[model samples]
Target: MNMAISSTPTSFSKSLKPSLPKARVFNLLKTPPNSHLRYTLNLKPPPPRLLFRIGNPKSKSQFKSHHSPIRSLFTGIVEEIGKVKQLGSDDDGGFTMTIHAKTVLEDVNLGDSISINGTCLTVTHFDTQLFEFTVGLSPETLRKTSLIELQMGSLVNLERALKPSTRMGGHFVQGHVDGTGEIVSTEPEGDSLWVKVKTTPELLKYIVPKGFIAVDGTSLTVVKVFDEEECFNFMLVAYTQQNVVIPLKKVGQKVNLEVDILGKYVERLLNNGVVNAIK
Candidate 1:
């Protein structure tokens, strides 16, 4: 499988600063044991946060972010599946998209961020009565991600940004897709499924047996790694098989792949001599 990277300054995210990499995939892929849904054991409703404000606050619920909501974390636990309702080109070299969803729209406001597949997108327009929302996609985002593969009626995994009180059963997922890869194969082992994905060597370097990876936004653990083949595999149990869109995909399909962020951070530190300075 061919894996490509784009360092283009534009972003698919309307909210992220130009520095954040363009989103690479939306058919993005993740599993349960590695899922952070378990971390949300704190069932208490999160204390009200100091909502970021805009020109004038109509209400606390109308808050918006002036920049990327990077402070927010995603635990790679999918909440629901959404379908693309409308898609078309915008004059600004981007696209306008409206998706049909319920769970992610419950309290969604003008600037709220929702991870479509594994890419975080801000809500630009929405309608509670219709259960749909619209967001803008930059051209770089389309060049880099599988979202370009999306069409009306395509299913996408949906996840909301984590609140102090939200449940976290998966691992910390940055929702910044590294790139796209092909689902090379799939096998079923009774009540579970074993799937293999082939990506580039640069991405495969961070994947290890038992390490965490977010596929299309579902947090899952790596079951095996095949360095020579530039691929890896993971299993989805009966429960996850039904909850996510991964199991439903076929061989040769493209899925979003976000290797754990920790590895990249460490690499950056090592390269910049931050680790050496600390030592």
Candidate 2:
């Protein structure tokens, strides 16, 4: 989905100057730049507000689900770290990506659904000896995801679709990216690790404390969520820090995000007034 960002016009900007609350105006005028008294006045405003959305904030979910719902489940347990061998735009304005992978290729077949950085894609071709597979991405997927920015040799988390016999290690992931988020900061907190990520306001609404979120195809529990800041916190255990690709990411690196699916379903039911109809 394309976002139309509107800049504040000269007239609107001028109007805002006088509409500041009296307390804010006094604080701004009297406080010194470096003084604690100016802290509140200098507090950063929240990130840009996005247009409200009723469906999954990530545009990938806006596409129709092609496979059966049962075949859509992913455990978010990355089977392997795949490296991009080739990535280029196709004549159709989409993209074609070939990944060098091993474990994920063990039983993979053409038409199999694979989760690459939390985005589900169908395998179009593969070479068993070379341990490589190709997937085509649509133009819409490129716009809403960070995958388009991937370069050759970039590493990505890979997972195959869940089977009934597979152990349920992580939360259910549909491989439908809700959006992309950037790592704002990372620091060690005593024995654990704390990482904060900035995201859009539309995506922030569905996030909750102790909620499930898929980051770079790994399911993690949210430690805290700052609605006003448009950011969320995640506490990482030693195992997570050692295994997931996110820990290797720097502050500015973008990560694919998939909000809890339950929130999307609830929003749909509420928006359609299904409860009222049932009554």
Candidate 3:
């Protein structure tokens, strides 16, 4: 089945300045910056206070009216790191999955965004303890990533859809794994290791020096880039604990890769005629 998604722009009204209490005003005047007491004594009384009316705070209803719900965001913990209970194809040629997650229902809702490994899937059903979600992988998504190789007890990271107020801690990620890359080599560099991975040519343009990239849902920065006849190779330098789990990555091990979303948008603008050109 084809998935159709849409997004709406968000807006905010100007915030009204709150009236300062008398104590606070006196404290400000006492500060060193306002030590010119003689000059202030000559000044006339403050102008008639104009009472600024403060409107009610924006509510979820207001947000819903102005924005699309599918674009909402959430983040959840990996409770039990449950395995793939079952996987099979449905009548419509779509894939069905029964993931038995422990503590999934503790905080997860019906439409939460759960990042299984690096791929985001939506919650379809749940009880008080566990929940089930489904991901309909396309032929291209299946061919490009290691989702098919997921076993019964694979550890996966989970995150809910993002809210407008949420601080973007990681680079913008769509939870869409673009392609699978093989680990080339890893060398210890002080407390960190410089990891090299072989990536596709199309993904190479976004892999810039010091640019951000996500491997298996973990955001990492690119340190260097190299090109060969077989593939474009790049090294990611990360700290010990952060780089260890993924560095043991075998020479030919396939890893889910998600290029920085911001990079992709910038590329689109450069190609579409928004900016004069990207320098």
Query: What TM-score, over all chains together, does every model reach?
Result: 0.75, 0.73, 0.59
User: Model 3: residues >4 Å from true position, as ranges?
Assistant: 1-82, 100-105, 127-136, 189-191, 229-249, 277-279
Model 3 lDDT tens row, 1-279: 222211100100001012333232222112233222223223333222212211223211211111123354332222234456555433332334456665544677665665565666656545554455444333233344555444444445545556688777666666677666667676775665666777777887678777777676666667777755334334444532342235544555556777776788888897898897544
* Top lDDT model: 2
Sort the predicted structures by TM-score, highest score first: 1, 2, 3
In the range 166-240, model 2's lDDT, one tens digit per residue, is 999999999888888878889997767899998888899999999999998899899899987889999888877
Error of 2 at 38 (Å): 34
**CA lDDT, every model vs. true structure:** 0.69, 0.70, 0.49
Q: Which ten residues in a row have the lowest lDDT in candidate 2?
A: 8-17
Would you list the rank order by lDDT, best first? 2, 1, 3
Clashes within 3 Å, all models in order: 16, 1, 5
* Candidate 1 per-residue lDDT over residues 1-279, each given as its tens digit: 111222222222222223333233222332133322223232232112211211123432212222234656799999999988877543233356778999998889877778887887768788999999887655445545556556567789999989988777999886677777778889999999999999888999999999999998899999999999989999999989888889877777667888888898889999999978988
Superposition TM-score, candidate 1 onto the true structure:
0.75
**After best superposition, candidate 1 residue 50: deviation in angstroms?**
40
